[model samples]
Target chain A: MKANLTIISILAILFSSCYKDKGNYDYAALNKLEIKDKNGVINISIIFGDTLRLSPEITQTTAQNEENLTFEWMVFDNSPASSYALPKTVIATTRNLAVQITEPPFVLSQNYRLTYKVTDKRTGVSSFLFYNLTIINKYAQGWIFLEDKGGAGDFSMLLPNGTVEYNVYSSLNSAAPMSKPVKLEITPFQITDDMSPSSKKIYLLTETDGMEVSYQTMQKKFNYGFLFYAAPQIIKPTRHTWVSTSTSATLSGSLGVVVNDGKVHTNLVGGFPGSKKWGASLLSPAGNLNYITAPFVAGGTTYTAAVYDVLNKRFYSVGNTVLSAFPSTASTVFDMNNVGMDLLYLDSANVVREYNAVFKDETNTPYLLKFKTVSTTGAPNLTLLKTQMNAPDIVNMTAAASSTLTPHIYYGVGNKLYRYETTSNTTFPQFTFPAGETVTKLKFSRQPLGTSQLAAVTWTGTESKVYFFDVSNVGDFTTYTNVYSGFARIVDLGYKVP
Target chain B: MRSYIYYFLLLTAILAACGKDNRVMYKEDPRIYFSKFATNPDSTDYSFGVKPVGLLTDTAYLTFRIMGTAVDKDREIKVTIADSSKAKAGYHYNLGPLVMPANAYEVRVPVYLYRKPGLKDSIVTIDFTIEESKDFKPGYNDKPGLNVYDRLHYKISLNDQLLKPASWDSRLALSFGVYSKTKFNFMIVTTGKTDWNSTIFPGDQNFLIQTVKLSLYNYEQANGPMLDENGVRVVFP
Candidate 1:
């Protein structure tokens, strides 16, 4: 009984010591700050490279004189903190924040924590207002049109919302102008030694030069010479193509083929965050004869690309380090080593392992040759259909593009567009432009996850315009989706996707 | 009152155990060993065959790292050739003065090798050992299970005959084609590079090939066709 009484007495004493104490003290309330945009919202979104202007309505309950308070605006990357410290940038010291957002754009919209601190110099008290900011890339998703203005050229972007951003290349790369544009290529995912993780790369090819630019800023990354283990003697680059196959769920292995001076060079497209340089000129080792190849190449996931040798009028397969001739087989549909015709256009057809090539004989007769670049057993199989085109306007076609989802080849003659079915050897007239308008280039969107749309550029005497047509599963132009005008003779167009 | 004393004693013990630990974990003596590069930890090899015929001597550097903290005073390192070495120290090679500067964790020792007449017909190897000095003692030995070699020892081979580069077949062959001694010598003369290794970038390889191709064309135009040691017509792929 005595022990219990003693414990209870101690507990009572402790409870008595924890009693709230009210003392005579003088206290002052802190300055309360409220910050908001004109729409009364604290969170905002802006595009990369655009100026961010925020004249928030800041209210302080305790401070009436603006000169007695100082303001500071700071921004921090809202990504989860890593082992290394994250960077915090002080953007402005004035009450109104105005600064250019030059930070790198992420693949997705990046979140940033914007903080506005208002300090009262009199009492050394401060108030803070926080904002959630999102930054988006201007070049995230669009159609890049290369405009050729005589010898000098520029690039324009046709956004999905029917808006055109003209001369985007010149606006971004003012000092480094593009000239004699040849081709435009977009690498959905590219990793280099200097870039961590992966990034999208845009390749701008010209007659005498080749350049790689950032997909986000359109800023030049490197020139054509940097693309090779050793650049060729001639600087005439005709085409650069990339083909990749997923090696794992999160990793892909790619191969790059560059055709310069009518010679083919190849390299492993990208390393897992490493640099890959093109190898030597791929030529037949059996002969000491000089070789010249066509500009167009058909690439596949088998780490090999097919190029047509113009001098010998034959097809050659280029691997990582060697150029090899397709094995001659009597059962083959056509002799790969003796096509005997000049290759006009060569591209991968919609079917897997199948390629469509258009060739013209000396008599001006156009022939459509459809063959599998590689067979199921990893051997060259030229056993598919090969027939002479019966369409009268086929020989007059100047531009050609192949579909990826259907075995259809879209060709342009003057101002008319036609689709040729390789399986049925039939041609169908798709569309016709106004008088004096001539088709200059034709391309199909090659984005892996994008819709199958055919993009055609036409020069209408005074200006150039691009037309997008939605393609049906039956290889027909179902609808005219969009059209963008006001370009300077667009030479090539490619779809850029995040 | 007794329970209060017990509570106070327990709190005192908990606070006493919160003191910082200052235990030493490293040995007091400083040690040094031959450092291995991240790219290549094995012994290095050199050949005068890649150099111009007129060149007679070249220098190679062997690096050493210390296992202790850097000091503010310069120290001398002692190096000696193994008794079983095939190359004579004074006749075929000479060791430069070895000095590790103050506040440095690593130092490079230069070995000057000569193109002796015997080296043209036969390869010579010099095995080096790091000896104890006033500042440092020989450090890590071989760890066979870990595939690591002795850090206290290093070896270098010297030859005057044209030897094929390691990357000849896998990398250079595609650009330069077949490999031959005469072709390699001509490439050295054309590119003026004595250090041809596997680490050449693709762009550099292309540049080298282009440079040599042009030079080869010029040479053949001036002097019929160049032939290799086997009498094969030298050609670039």
Candidate 2:
């Protein structure tokens, strides 16, 4: 009880002293202004000016003046003030003051004002000033087309709302896109075709009434008004053969690519009036019409395929070489050297060997068929690679190059795909696609109980469905979770309800 | 020593008198009550307050008063309706004049607490047999329809292929020979709709589907059904 009395006595003494008058003084200030824009957004910055003596009562001692200065800043108006600190701002002790006005919408050509005030604490006097600002709008605006027209085959572009416009090439150069692009207005189109096929170029035109038009030259009896729907279709060219006078025909095969024993085989579609044809060619022992050789030029090279020769230790390709021997029928030729192939199948080299499929890139730049190394293991590892004829777009691959080594890969080149073998280390034996042709669709399939096979599909006309057998399994791969299939036409859209 | 003791006693009395002044100036006695003291699930936020029409009527209110002494200690004063049987889940307004003398002040706000039934109108009420005081009288006022649930919403998708003959005419022709029929898997889904059986959960509902068949004769009878008038007569021939 006695201790409590002592504490109460001390508190009583302290309370009386709290009300003592120490003299009246006021110290406050508002300062500098700054403005900034972030992508058409505006912001403001302000800094407090140096302390000023507003009254005569303040000490004028030069040496003590600096240490005695103090200031408090505030924002006033209908706007509520905040204690949030701005950049470079600090508790004022003379040369302190800065504030930032965050970005907010402003009238395009309206003037805004910020008010500031300052008071001398020692003298109890104050002064005020206001700064005015104006805001201006900057101009930034262009149209962009998503699809380019130079590449082989036809494809459609889709708008954000799912409207589609088909793209068909009439020639290498055209000012405006063909106004008669196929109209795919239904729900997102689905690929009814089961496999990949060959690629062909079809000229598209718009009639006077805006209907999609393609040459129906396939009829035995050519006549006008032969109505047929230009269904989106993929065709694969298996081989090139001379039809009647001035006509070349292609046999159509499956619409996908496949892989077997590490060798690559693709389904090819043959075409007339440019039809997709399916066939295979290997050189016979005789070196006439079957083997052709020429100096490997940097450009103008076409048709690359892998052909295994059971008779020789090497492989044959229709590249950088003339026909050494010709076969009258579609026979499996087994002699590699007779066909003028410089390099045969190297059983242990698991490196990708590419063939030039198309001659030019989107910029019309010539490209080459070159193979870099990919993954390799076990004896006789194989690597079959396909690059987009004119680009480096590569896909549907197997057995990558060793992780330690990076392959100089290309895109949008022949096929934009490849097949590599882990056992033979070579491209599969097969015939090549004709010049100016591309394998747009490469799909692989396996029956529920039958052996797995490669299907190659290609786009031939404005609308052509073609399929082929992929001797070289390239594109079109199926896994437990995903099945990659090609559509007759460029798939406009796809959606599935849960 | 005796004189020193007296001096200390005098100082102690002065300090005690000052402390008493502080305590007496800050007394706390808070009271709360609802204007309408009944517990009902259909209660709205404003229902507890007296209505304008009842201005002259003597209204009985449930008063919750809290009395305190000296220092302000945190306390909970709960005002619950003893008739738990009629209790339902809903919004209720608690009324308060909440006044005290200048020395008596409140440090915290008063709150109301009540439990809600899981199902709508599912709680069965047991009559309050407990007798009411002779001076007490139950309050009465107008009542509004309780919005048990918002209007039900329906999503309908029609498939003509599945709705063929009965649900729809595929060909849309009134001739028997030309009559074409298709079927559709009509799916009718409902949400926020009233469940007559109250089998559905409080806010969830299931979808329903019913298939029907259509024929040319029936289509003609309704409006030149699947069979035209002439075709309908030809069938008799």
Candidate 3:
């Protein structure tokens, strides 16, 4: 009887639990959203100044129409993590995104986080999709030519892929037309305190003034007056160069040397990024004012910059602030402190620590002075090779360029280019331009491995042309690789190194 | 079962140990002392000689810092001149009223220094000490083991003389030629700047050099040739 009662109680409990308890519960399907790029790609790349257009396919499971959803697109800088917050910009509020990219190009391809958000208005639920966007600089790596369009200055670029861009400066900066172009330089290092990713600067020097512009966008940063802590009263900027020094095994910096009105001034570059303005004129070893005639400096180890003093008619090596003359040891080669000839051109040679300078005596006899500014022991090793050049037309040379891989110096006279060998004292004709054309500028590409390429510019009465030649190992013009025409007088050409 | 109960109690104790701490920190006594003037504490003395370029007076700020938490109300700080001070309070210098503003951790007390005629020949010094005030007491002293005299006491010396600037040798000599009292005075008169240091930007230095050159040329045209104190004609490079 007890077993029967237990079994009946268990059956009663099971039946009671099985009875349906009706409650106010409702069933509804959730609106699922799926978003993807039209091509199923999550990474996109576009050049600066180009239009970025993206169309994404959206799918919703519910019956709600696309009109019931709101879309938003945002772009944020996806650079490496920093102490400061990155910037975010809302691009569009529509389903499709089509916007012009106006951001500054970095030294490297800049990454940007592109987010697309869709919201269901009825349910107030948001769905987000992210994409990796890359922005490349259009004028990132190219050959930049500063030319004189009529009287105003403009810039032209020849991309590595044989694309030519003309009027680049005027097209970007219409309001501020550059003056008569004199020189163009690129400092491929951090110079200012802003710590920008694209810290490289393009220095555009005119006849009467100069200005620093962005290497990527060609936008003006500051004028020549601001380049100095105290600008000279007479602003006749001739040239600018950089001297890099490694203070420690891991720490390095550069000094920007500018020759203005025959005076040399220096400003710190790299190392601790800050507003380093050019200070007073560098003094001579005797603690007196001196004038530098050469626009270019032959810089070597430990900030040793060899410059020619027109006033003293000597070669002085500049170290940070002052100029020190070479040792007065009498040598059969030549006297460094008494190189009584006028300096025609000065640049580093193809050999390490060797500088090649072209000078002319009172009789207009052209001579080549090759000397190492410092020896391996950091002492003055002045004389290397001093001989009279066999090339007679070198006195009329208008433009000159040298390479670190050859012992020959290339110079231009009128429409003819000649190569003078330092070892044999020989002259050879390299190339010739069209009739009535004069070579305006010649520069060997300073890129580390691309030094074999030489860029030569020639100007006729009304138009200019630039020619690129592949130089042989023996300093001979092997091939005419490329030529660009329909340009104004190109005063200077520089490579925007990557 | 007993082991299970023990393990449960151990887990509960470990979780309780992770609770947020509510204990308060110990506070130090509210005190004040004269702070070191420069970033380097070893640089204790603060002295500046007035250049002989018509600068009649100058002001120097003596900074003071607090030791305790900041309060909302302004606090009074007592500053007294030591007996070894050679500068007369009324004639040579006048110490301004000392008060730390509400919630301020540091205060800069201004002391006005006069370029009296006697300073042209001799330098006068003033030693300052922080004393006990109504709201705060003196801080870090020169105890046997304590290294706080640079913060507890300060001294200032003033003078008026024509001294050669340090940068004249390295930088200014190239633009302005050699150093001379007459040339330096001419520079001061032309540029209206008594302080010519390395901080002066190159642009401003060039502008000043040009201005002085022009002024010297005009002065020579008006009053024959401008001569130095030694009766030598002043020239610029």
Candidate 4:
């Protein structure tokens, strides 16, 4: 019995070895049988190269019944360090012998690969195959930047790498560049200019070499002081302080600088000090302080003040009303109700209207008379005139016609700067440059020379230059050309110039 | 021999009676399905909450009962908010496996996932009112594009116009939170509908899931001070 057991063990081993011993029967026979191996099977194919179709090519072996034999599938990653089999569900069909992979779709801008394999169930045989697969993603054009100067920031720039740089230009000087660049990191860059003051393209560029260039569109200019803002400060060259009369003053509203005791303080005149404080009230009626372009008293009847509620700070005036000076503010000074109350000096009949209220004349034309009512019906009969005179060529009056007060009209008729008096329809003043250089800024001046008679004006004639003028005297005030040359433009006055 | 024969006949008769009844029976009551789930009240959907972001102390009991004869007691709740088709999907709530106890009773548990940066969906209520949590931090940046979507309940102010200063990037941030029937706490942070939020770091007690978008100076025209007409909208999970 022992001999028989040993002989049987050897025979069994011999039988197992004989199966493989056929000197490797035609690889064709293995392919003919259905594979049913406990180990897995894997099939690989090029799913889409020439035409979106998986082309399976068996390279290592030739099969006699390749078409009749069913290929059980499995897969292994050639690149991975450890051997990995495809999820059991990976199956291949006879139709194009395509390998199907089941998995979630690939994410955008991501990479992934799926391997397919197959094996024959009838014969305990299997084969391995694989192909590399990858996915690509699309890009987007993301962001842009814009510039603002008015209420908005100075210059908004969108960089190539999707960052925004904001540059605040100090002034519109051709020589000065904006302040330091503030870098803002962002994607899909974009910007807006609505924050800018003027609705125009404003830019400041500094080349690699640091050369700077600034540009702005030109418009009519005015002298601030010579206009209606000058009043009440006329001390007439006090013995203590040197009377440095100005030949030019800017008309840039009353928000400029006030020099006090050698230190600059904001007068807060007409309101906002431009100090970057949020919600600063300028010329608030609640504050009991109102401001207007021109304030004057004419006739014996001290006509009401054409006070502009500067707090609104709008180009167009809305609730502009005229009222008498409440002794609480302006002191009891001139007898404004009398005809001697020269509110404005007209170049034509030399007449002045004291209370230029909102009104229409006999011709139903809106005129800046002492007491008149303006109708809000049809277009108001108001026209833009040149030269302050009653009769001059009518240019286009861009503002609303129904406005009864004299519009602050500015125009350059040759070298002279003329401002129309709304209250005194016929009279307007001229800002004459004593020298032949280009005019720079028009701003309102603080501390009028002769509170009752003079208005200040400032202009630029040359580089590092300044000129000041006082147009208070009654003569041909237009003839004072040499006064501006001698007067210095109040150096370091802290006035914001355009 | 006669005595043994008598005993066998008795045993046969008893076995015969038992064969008549095929169905199995039990004296105990069947388990009924209970709908109430756990709630984390302190865990808000707000990204940057008035309080710190972390595990919430306030909790509500969550219990369920099965009323059928079957022994099956497994339960799962799907929590998700509506999302844009383009954005990848995220999980809102998932309550793992729980075995029903012999007796029916309520259970209170703490909320874990406090906040994230996705939209909020219905079903999960943080408190009484179903509101999107505030989770965005406001700041300025330069990327000019749409940012992430938030899923907390929040009220939008339509009257305020979106205004970005020129020459400077806008600074914006946002935060929010969500409630979970399964998980105790959930939250998300997103770019608030308005472009007024920036990215925030981890350490400073933040549980709002959110994302940030940047741009140079978009909200208005190129040269004047004005705001755009784009309105604010919130996404829900």
Candidate 5:
């Protein structure tokens, strides 16, 4: 009882101390930060490689003084405000704030907020001024065609202004000659978390050396959550033959990179998974990841997805579960595209897959082979559909209506377009490109709201031509319109919705 | 300690309530009916055209299904033909009687729609209804996917190939490239009359593509592509 009374006395004393008010004081600054730029707002527009200089005037009341005050001018990409200890966000804290827009973090048509913060050394109070700059580029929107100058790759942008700029990468990065650019992937043309404007992100995955340009940008911000390395986390990936990215069925809204590889990995970067790739969970058998490489194609629904392994000659796709391996008999998995449930990959046989709801995903969905040699009635020559896809001339596939409903995938065989039927394992010869020209790349420009325009780059001995066709009709090359001509060898083509 | 035990029990009860209760109670027997998808094989109108040079006929089968329980006794239901001016039963076509046998949830009725010139100057509907039977009453009716005709009654017109129904274009079947007759016929029978209208967008086309494409047609029983009116394999590209 005596011990309990002693504890009660201590509790009463603590409660009384909590109610006590030592003193009340207002240490907030009598100062205001003012920044002056081009317009009323402190927002300026700067193109790539353009220098920005700003000297803002600070206003203060009679109570405030300039002595014993410190000024910090920092640059950040949408990072929250902070006080006390400075975040490693000092882009340029040198003698004077002269931003040398030489590298990335300086992406075209993007907004970067510049913070001019002032702190009173005595009061420990800070005032910050946020100013943003819209990074602009002459070749901002439209189709970007990548060219391979031997092993070193360069890109040309077909601007909305109807002019194709020859070397866009060279103007921004002087080291572009050294880095071998393999494939370039941009964030999906959808509304992202930060409502970031389109064309703000363009990831140029290269072949080794310095990460200087992109590395410095990533330190301050996570743009579109997309990261590329000739060497990424865990298994370093590069020199991939085929690459595709789509919204992950496993991780909603997030984009996953599927590559035809010695090891197929979807854990690269983007929305659903910020930095962590969700592909490692797909491993059931040891080294099963090796069987799935390259030629990753997106199926409409998660149920009809096709991830073909050219090396193992198998399919590693996702169903209700992240299926590590489905011993698919499909021998030659051709270009996999998704228009509803249309299967793009065909063996030597061009067999059709019936995306049975019972068996979602591309694996084990009933298959049909309508070949001249095979009978469609009995067992459908399951062995043949797995072994061969009939159109031998099929070098590449470009889907009409990119990511649109009722889209059509045109299989470019030599010069003819073989339209594949997902439900019936058959291909109908649609239209053919002009003579002496082989399609180097087939692409589609995504129009806003599920609309798409089809375009293809064809090459011959000395020239490459880009042709535009109406993808409005699922598979019809008859609507062909010549977009551009006379380029060396078109390596890759990416279209921004105009 | 006693209060904590009570709280844990309450939480456990709430969790139990949230769990899936697949337990179905036949509180008085829930009724059944012929499925709307079951009303038409491919959910397409029974269409045909008389060949001028050759004598031809087609007999497509429509399915009968019980919605509630499978009975042990054989049940025969009466079907009354809709007496319209365009169609006469003995003149244009012959439809066999429908019977649900012992312990069966499904059965097929042969709806023989024929096109003999002078049977009718134009297309005609061979509409019918499942009258109440001694063994079973009208099982269950109101369904979402069923067309207006199939929901309350079963109807198929003796439509000519040239005068096919306008509804065929917007069908869920078109998503699977069934713009032609043979593909349509193949889609229906191969699917075994599963409802497509209700589950079109997210629905599985696998059974139709994978299994049905490989199955021999009940009427043709051939192992090749289904050709269109042009005599070429129907390629809707």
Candidate 6:
């Protein structure tokens, strides 16, 4: 019996080995598939209104039946970046064997996942191929509102969509190289000019750095900063401006820099970091609290800019030859941040003043103590424009976007929104928000199609909302088109120049 | 033996029937909410509470309810008043010292409203949210939805308006008047209807109502409604 058991064991082992060993495995028989055109980074740069078409060749093993299969192509935001864009749900899907592209958010470049899932209907076997689609920006030309997300700010791109797109920066620049969520408190961004497409493109000014974005492509641009891949060198300047004629790359723009380095200097041409080279030109004598007043050119060459020493409360003009007291004000220029040569200051009685360069009669300022064109006192002709009871505690002046009507320049005075009409040289009440609402920031945006509208950000202790009033006609002041909202206590606002 | 088995079976059935899903059914979790889900308050959607005017010592409870397994020790929950809320912290009213005792389901926040006599128009609102605290989490709402919605917070609208704004249109709500509390309530409640609301778009039906608020108030007074409703105070033109 023992001998029989041994023989039987040997025989069983031989049979099992024979059953397990089915000769050399054939690689061709395995279910295998490959995406033929899946080479290089999956990023595709597409111009606005341009159609994108791609059909990848799927190669499968001859032994695997590839004739009957199911396919699903989907696109969704796959960014784990909270500092950047909004909630990205599935924007598009296709069941065809090929990939068909659709209209992307034109405000900024969107990070999308183009997926191809192929399933063998007969065997229930499936394979998936994913390509990261970087839709390079194409049309960011409009009012780009920014959200000061404390540490990591959020951006909204209102395309010339007649109004604006909310929180567009996250979508526009989140995936670009050198992209990072902020690690510090971010103030509201600033733009130094009225953007003109051919002459100016919007350049957002930040405390830490600067960013230049394409108006047509909406694709954000970066430059060779002090740190090639980190913050721009333009950080920490108390204030900066483009001294050049226009901000367009085609235009040569000089930069005005006022730093606490105890000096007032100007940099080479261009408003944004990309065009602003690593250089500086002194504008004032050192050791003074130099505050650079914006340049004012009365529609001609030889514009004038002044430097105010807050410590001494004096003004000195910056010219092609020398930095001296502006031909108008010697030592009487009040430290001022202007609204188009119009200074906003609280008088001794704390009355809000929108002091513009108006032709005030002999009644005010006894004559022209100091000022530019229009009067003996180019000094701001400030009138008590806001005295509303429910007006919020004014934070400060934000941007001055023009009105559609003859009157331009909007002020976010607490809860009350005031408009200054250069036509009448008068500031009138534009919109008086219901009580409890505070206008945090106001800006004027010039849409690509030419809509001179003023946008305002209002905070309701509980929420932040945006409103746009068509300034084309003063009679339409009461009603406004609330454009977009859901922002942090707004820090600042600016309209895209071009 | 058969009778004994019957008794055992009956006892088992009774226990099964009596067993409760003691787990509090929270709308969302890790956070406390201001709602009527588990509370015993009258379902007035008192989400918008209206207190009578001229009541000097009037106090309304902004009861916030939370559902989950109640804790064993009294826990303190911190609530934050959004920076957007214009209400004063101490002068107008006082908040906090909010407590959800062990084995408790909700916390009733006491808001003592102040009223100065002869004030014809007044609308004050208190907007507060449950700040993330060690005691509890704010909320976790992964519910699939649309059109159907729910809130775990409260906004007390103290007013003397003849008709509380029921319109979902922000412009129409604003047209009612300058009552801060009322307008605030209208803005927060009818967010989707306001074009400024980033959350609602494309499908929001109440958006069209804003045109009325935008029309030059004088123009509306001159031309009435641009789209007249035969006789209805021209909803908005």
The candidate scoring highest on DockQ is: 1
Q: Of the pair 1 and 2, which is ahead by TM-score?
A: 1
Runs of candidate 5 exceeding 4 Å displacement: A1-133, A178-182, A189-201, A205-255, A258-261, A266-292, A297-306, A318-323, A326-403, A418-430, A448-451, A473-477, A496-498, B1-237
Each candidate's DockQ score against the native complex? 0.17, 0.00, 0.08, 0.02, 0.01, 0.01
Please, what are the lDDT tens digits per residue for candidate 6 over residues A64-124? 5446766666656653332345544443344433333445432234456667677766667
Q: What is candidate 1's CA lDDT for residue A344?
A: 84
Please report, in order, the local distance difference test score of every candidate based on alpha carbons: 0.76, 0.26, 0.75, 0.26, 0.48, 0.45
Sorted on TM-score, best first, the list reads 1, 3, 5, 6, 4, 2
TM-score of chain A, every prediction, order shown: 0.73, 0.19, 0.75, 0.21, 0.51, 0.49
Score candidate 6 by DockQ.
0.01
Candidate number with greatest lDDT:
1
Lowest-sum lDDT 10-residue window in model 3 chain B:
B38-47
| Candidate number that wins on DockQ, 4 or 5 | 4
lDDT of 4 at A215: 14
* Model 6 spans with C-alpha error above 4 angstroms: A1-49, A52-139, A162-167, A171-202, A208-234, A244-263, A270-278, A281-300, A304-309, A319-322, A328-409, A420-427, A446-451, A473-476, B1-237
lDDT of 4 by residue, B64-169 (tens): 3234433433322222223321222223322322434333332222222223333222223322112211211121221223322221211111111122311113
**Deviation in angstroms for B166 in model 4?**
34
Would you give me the overall lDDT of model 4? 0.26
Candidate 3, clashing residue pairs?
A229-B202, A229-B203, A230-B202, A230-B203, A230-B204, A231-B203, A350-A404
DockQ winner between candidates 1 and 4: 1
What is candidate 1's lDDT per residue for B1-237, written digit by digit as tens? Answer: 776665576567657889999997966678888887534444767998777789999898888888888899998888788887899988889988788889999988788999999988898989888899988888777642322357888888899888888768887787888999899989988777876753665545554665676567668768988999999999887
lDDT of 3 by residue, B1-237 (tens): 655565576568657879999899897878998765323241122223424456677787788889998999999998788898889998988988799999999988788887778876776778787889998889977522223355667777666766677568987888888888888878886777876752554435544654676567668768977888888889776
A284-366: candidate 4 lDDT, tens digit per residue:
22222333322211111121112222223211111111123222212112211221211221111122222223222234333
True contacts kept of 5: 0.00
Can you write out model 1's per-residue Cα lDDT over A424-443, one digit (the tens) per residue?
A: 78888888877788888988
Write down the DockQ of candidate 2: 0.00
